[model samples]
Target: MLTGNGGHLQHLCAQCTSCDEHAPSLPPESIVQMPEQNTPSGRSSQICSDRRQCIHGISRQTNWVVRSSSLPQRHHIYKISNHFDPIFKLEAPDQISTDGGTNLASEEMEAFFRRWLVKVHLSSAQYPESNGRAEAAVKSAKGLLQENTSKGGALESDKMAWRQHASHGDQRVASCVTGYLQLKEWTNTSGIDRGYGKNNVKILHVRREGVVHSIKEYEINTQLTLNNDKDYIFGDNSDIIATDSQKNTVYILAKKHGIVSPEDFALLLCTHFLSKYPYVEKAKIDVDAYPWRRIVSEGKAHNHAFLFSPEIQHTCTVSQRRGGSAAINGLTGMRVLKTTQSAFVNFVDDEFRSLPDMKDRIFSTIITASWQYNTVDGVDFGKIWANVYKLVIDKFAGNPDTGIFSPSVQNTIYLLQKAALDEIPEISKISVTMPNKHYYTVDLSKFPEVGSLENNEVFLPMDKPAGNITAVLGRATKSKL
Candidate 1:
């Protein structure tokens, strides 16, 4: 069954470690005897516990020492240390309240402060009160223009109106400053005149050094995909592969979009290699396809055409490297599932901490996976991404016995990425990043005392901080060949 450069498979076998099979399955009798454990009162009953009833697989009030293996032996390991310092200055301000003991509304004071800062320091120094001058100039110019204009034809009248409007705008600055100065006391205005005028000789300085900031406001374009024909939908699938034995250099099998569907339009955006630039036999070529569907939708339930959305996704990538250069890339989303495979333990504790037991708590995070493809020389490139996604999911849920129990988010990421590398016939390794979005339940049974966590009560709060982020890196092997 080996095709095209079969010797490459032999080299892979030599480099790979032997797969181990130590997974155990429970006996049938034990399953029949297992009774559902339910409590009459607490929080939620969804939390599961082992036969030993340990919360999250850890004991409470116990300190676990962590040490780095790379450290020098001479350095003495310190187990636990605690120090305290005030996080913020809580001293009362010295400002006296003018309005009794009633607290001032911060919103009103903040607005007034912002206005003061801009008007006093930001306005032009030479024309501090330009409002009075701007208003008087505008009024004098408008009065002079109106005094000369007479009733005339539509065209003549329009011309006179335009001239008057422009003349008014020419004096707008003097009018604005004149209006602002009217609000202040005329006696207080002596200070403004003394600062700018000297020896009854006026001096003018052209100040054009002021900086003007322009914020380019933009609207978030959410509907980025252009499916004008409504072609791509939930259940649609496609595959593109390059085959050496086949007559065609590239072969693609895509599900037909809905009649007048633009699903393929979205696909084209995603597959830049195929759409932006494509090739067959080292020559540029455009993709040619004729639409075909299994059944036409007459009403509800016509033949099982591609559904709008499906819970399962299966994709694969296969490529042959010209110079022993293999690359893998993958993206996985919408594989939604609800499980309590997550657990949290190994955290520092002090006197302020009052968490119940650290035995069996549910830890969960939504998973998003993307990885590059690494190909061995002359290996099957048709099914790489598909295999990678499948292997990762299988390792996460299917191999619970060996994969993620008592596992940190970092451990889960390493295992998931490794599983993908294992089945990827030629891929050397994979890089993965996983964010741990914590789903915690609030204990709200009692007012002061939070409900005991042991009663198996659980609630999910969405607006909370995400857990730790873990990433796996792939290191290349360099040899002097």
Candidate 2:
């Protein structure tokens, strides 16, 4: 329902369109099956009249070109010319405000309205200009639709139509985000906090950035067994390897061991120290690696690199004690954004909540992922990095032209970790932290004409107070399985 400039209630109805390619796919159950029984797709050819104050409830005419019961449930996103024609065919208001759902979202859907010269303004659930009227309209409309469809009543079409409309949006309507919700339901009240235990090697919780080595560079931090009662207690420097020697060892060993990948180099350093100094009990080491590329000379990349690009960096950590086995981990950073096909909605609804359910939004995030390796054997670190990197990135940013639907950073990051683990068995557990980079649409209500012209093209970026989301996923243990 839309509140007019005069502060009067104006009713709005849903037009359930086909799946948006960018929209997260709905559930298998939610895939609408055109029923065998004949029920008119409620629609009329009458065009909406130009009146700010429209009718109570508009009769949404279904412009179904094909009326076949044999039509299989939709699997792929297709642009139906006039599919799920909206109920607003009768009275087109100056603007239609939706609490949430597919309207004024997809390019094709927008084009459908452009042909009729109707302005599409997406109302924010974060900031409700109509106070509570926008929410009231959704609640009241849903209540009526549910009442009509109770016990499989005659108005089942209304229920079906409503669902189809809702499906065009995120979790509430239908999408992959629903799966995360289901997972959440199965968990404790603390909400999706997970931890894994592997009994061999200890984890060295150390991370330092900007390490320089070669074209590939790293900074190493080590925890040496300095004081062990008898060793350093007697003022003995025998067991303790000199810091100066460690420095020389790094430079001298670089020629013999060779630099391949960050993980390999890190493993080399930790193993060297452990093997050389037996009296030194525990040795925990961490390395951060960054890449540099050659500048483009004409059309080809120069043989000798000159410049550096700010791309995803790799992380490595190795911990080895005297008798215990070694533990090594790898990590990658993904800085990405999609102009469309991401949303945040259906969160807490308390007095403290000011942000609304944004149906479509400018979503960008700096994804930081770290995963523990199953074994520190002769693994191809570079190949594994490339494989996992492609999988994580491709899943988030689909084809360059079109991006996969990402409802929340939590859900998206979960998918990223899941994809990496499922595809690569070398990693046993993975954790990803994605901070929501918010871009608010510039308020164009002041200039309605300019707003209609520019549409959602203009936006304001936010740097401070970013929403932080993190999740950890691990493979099931044998006993649990």
Provide TM-scores for the models: 0.33, 0.52
Q: Could you say which candidate leads in lDDT?
A: 2
For model 1, the stretches where C-alpha displacement exceeds 4 angstroms are: 1-304, 310-327, 334-341, 348-358, 376-382, 399-404, 447-457
Backbone collision count in every prediction? Answer: 48, 9
Tens-digit lDDT track of model 1 for 1-481: 0011224323422443320110012111111111322322111101011112111100001100000012122212221000000100111111111111111113443243243221111112243232222222233333434544666522444343223222232231211211111111211322331100011111111112244211111111001122111112111211112222111111121112221112222232234333432321111111111222234366543333333333323222222221222233444333333355555565667887665444445545555554544533444433565576566676556665654464566776777776666655465656655555444566555645745634355657453656546575554679889
CA lDDT of each prediction against the hidden true structure: 0.31, 0.52
- Candidate with best TM-score: 2
Query: Candidate 2, 389: how far from true, in Å?
Result: 1.1
